[model samples]
Target: MNYTLNQLRIFLKVVQNQSVTKASEELHLTQPAVSIQLKNFQDQFEIPLTEVVGRKIYVTDFGKEIAEAAEQILQQVSTIDYKTLAYKGQLFGKIKISVVSTGKYVMPYFLADFLKMHPGVELEMDVTNKNKVVKSLQNNEVDFALVSILPEKMKVEKIDLMQNKLFLVGNMEEDFTKKKKIEAILENRPLLFRESGSGTRQTMERFIVQQDLKINKRMELTSNEAVKQAILAGLGYSIMPLIGIRREIQNKDLQIIPLKGLPIKTNWSLIWVKGKNHNPAALAYLDYLKKEKEAIIHSKFSWYEMM
Candidate 1:
């Protein structure tokens, strides 16, 4: 069967999503445009690539096999294109990363200077919980991942970009600056928690166990933003990454509570699977980080160091 690269891409996306509408949304193509390409690609193959029943699309077994082949072919083509750019002495290609939600605040600052330097390079970043971030790395779906807490099971290499500090935070109505016993501070203040599978939640769990503290669990939230809003509403207190709450602290909307062992420390690390062969753009970005990360942290995140 003869088919173009674009057709292969569209067909692969369709097969992956099992819906033309979802594929079009992800690819930034109109539904009709994706449908046209999918139909054209299907016409090239003698075997039926898809079957639709009751307005739902399903890829045939043969289509599943074809989609795997298409993925490999696309990867090869992308490598060749990237190598061509390198041969022309231009740093050009895509770098995809998956980051934990709280890491979003830090990841972009580290990327800005590098991206500015390599204008031809493109970036794709997905921010989600720690579970999804690690899953992306395990599946080889991204070049790297950013997390404050490393996965225990994955054999990976990492560059420690900067320190991540977690502190007890709440609305400024209470005098949280005075040093107080952990239990006293926690009394009557319900603990707002991130949903399970979050790196921040895992850290809080570890701290709770270490301190042998009992928490009045009030709400389980999915995102940092949700937890922040809950705290600002005076619904509860939460342990949050200082990086994500810098603006709130600066604006005096929130304050850090003083307690023994209050700020839990971890490094924000850029990690990748141990033996995966990264493409040129990814390798260049890694090298850039190794050389410039410390300088960037010194200039940008010096406030965390002072705390």
Candidate 2:
């Protein structure tokens, strides 16, 4: 009860990151200072907030509840700060965004421009799989989420940012002199796939089912980078987003396999929970995205035409 907002902020960060070291680095405070503040915060309650196991910090059930309360308090504070700045005809606050792994290719470009225009704003981005990204959104842990597929069960508002195409890709050195049907291709070459619960994997599965195709799954990789590497090493072919593999395709390390019903087109979207009150910074960024997203996408990813 006697703790300060700074202490709550530190506790929130520690809980979110599950590491005092990482929280200290993010808060720009000395490790000892962070430890002291956390200890102070914990002392206010009789129940232990967290426990250490194998060098990792794990929050208790009580800690999780406290962390959620702290998050709401921090968000309210940030909203108040943003509103004050807006009233003064200035913009300042933090923007927290979560993105699926494939979106990492283009989200940074958009963020760079936004940061340049509003130098007072701080940004935090979490890049992870679609499942985790959606979980973050469901928990209101981030201001926005960038993804190719929208969740069916969540009531949300979204805008299309750009075109996202999933193409069949393989090593250029692989001999495919003879054109083959989808069935033959699947049977002849092992298919590299993203791990379960990935947006890309879900899309690929739907496509396979719709086409009445069966896959010879060679391996399941956790990240797009890993799948790309596997394909580059001639391990197998994979259906990957064009945005993630533009560099490899340009360098001739990989080539798009042109087949019937190829290049499944989907839109990259910016989404936020419906009816949630967003801070001024989030609202401003949403407006900026609506007005400039097309131009930004065109200028940054014009290479999509080459694919």
Candidate 3:
């Protein structure tokens, strides 16, 4: 019914080391003190946590669950400390950023550059799928998200970083330009698709529907890298941002088919929960992105034709 923070800390240490004696060593407490804390923790709860299996102490399933929660609880306490320090003009705290997987290609380079410019700032980057990134942003687990898509009707501020031309891609071995129209190449060939919830997928889907094309029949892969590999393997063609496939196109490994009115151009945005207190570092990053968007894109894929 009652628990102490020391008990929680000791329980976490035991879980971390998976040995009471090792936990005692780590906590600078005696083995008996560590055992007592574990016992007290179990007594406060309805279930027992530690059991001796042969020569080692192990946790039950219930204990494992509690240990997991304890980790989060301790993490929150650390966050509070960081927040207090930040509030007191300590501009050297960590900022967690969750970005869509595709953004990994560009976001990390930019972040590294930023950190070099401001060595006092710490960054924690989580590259994830679109849905998970969105969920993390919504939960405030991340300071900001560098994403390609914004949910409709969400209270988020989007900064239009840049507009990119989505291209129809085929292998360089194929004469894509020979085809007068994009529809001519669309018949029976397998069309590669990005995983669901991808902004690129949504853009492609909307373009398909607008053109009255059928959505059935295709392979859906998770990452842009996978899609690129599929395309390189001649699995099928996909509509992808030019930034993603510039090297392949230049190396003469891939060819572009120009559709008179195909590949609906879209913008990438930097987003955060609106009306929430954002870290000053986050705001500074946003401004940096806006001010240097064109330069960044140009430097990365200098040869790619932009629309």
Candidate 4:
């Protein structure tokens, strides 16, 4: 009945990880400290929050529900803290965005200037796969989502940022110039794929379907960086975002093989729930993007088209 917010945080981390060691590591505390706090928290409730079996920890059903509630509680408390601090700065609080993995390369450049201008503003950007990005947006866990492919059922307002182009990318070892045929390039070389729900993978699938081609998915990676590494090692070719691989192309480590009906293009967009009320920082961020997007693109991303 007298558990502190710190206890709640410890308990939540323990439940999320189902491992006291991992929770301790993430909390930057010792295992004994995490265990002590978790035990203190659990003592306040009648039912068991977690159980240890065969030296492994497992969160009980009640623990899962309580963890969810704790997350909401912590989120609200954070909002309150930020709100209290807002009076100190011109435009203060947090700007939270969940972005598709490739978006990591793009979003930060746009945000750097804005953050510098508003010294008190804080940025929380989550770089994840498309599925997690969409889920976070749908759950209202983030103020905005940066994506190329919009979610199907969400009534979201989108601010188009710029073009996102996907090209068949390979290590320099591949002889792309000699064989431009879709079938020839796709033939012997296995295709490295991003896991399902990646925007690039979806785009690649659509391209395959449209061309009536089949790819041998010999290697699959969950992140753009990992895919790039696999390609650099000559594992296989992959359809990759030009933004994520521009440096590699420039360095001649990777080559973009232009093919007929290639370069699946889409617009990177900042999207949010159509009617959701945005906080002051979020609103200011949207306005900044609206006003400075063109200049930012010209100055920061002019090479996108050239690459």
lDDT at 285, model 3: 75
Q: Residue 79 CA error for candidate 2 (Å)?
A: 9.8
Which tens-of-lDDT digit does each residue in 1-307 have in candidate 3? Answer: 6887788899999988999999998789999999887887898877778788899988889889999999899888777877776777665556788888777765775566667766557788888888888899888898888887687667998777655568788886567545565556766567788888887788788888777776455889999999999888878888888777767877988877777666566666778889868777777777777787677767764565344
Q: Rate residue 28 of model 4 by lDDT.
A: 93
CA displacement after TM-score superposition, residue 8 of candidate 3 (Å):
17
TM-score of each: 0.76, 0.75, 0.69, 0.75
Candidate 4 deviant stretches above 4 angstroms: 1-85, 216-218
Which candidate, 3 or 4, would have the higher lDDT against the true structure? 4
When sorted by lDDT, best at the front, the candidate numbers are 1, 2, 4, 3
lDDT of 1 by residue, 12-120 (tens): 9998899999999989999999999999999988999999999999899999999999999999988787778788888998899999999999999999999998876
lDDT of each: 0.91, 0.88, 0.78, 0.87
Indicate the residue-level lDDT of 268 in model 1. Answer: 95
lDDT of 1 at 169: 91
User: What lDDT is reached at residue 287 by model 4?
Assistant: 93
In model 2, the runs with Cα more than 4 Å from the true position are: 1-88
- Checking candidate 3 for backbone clashes, the offending pairs are none
Error of 1 at 220 (Å): 0.9
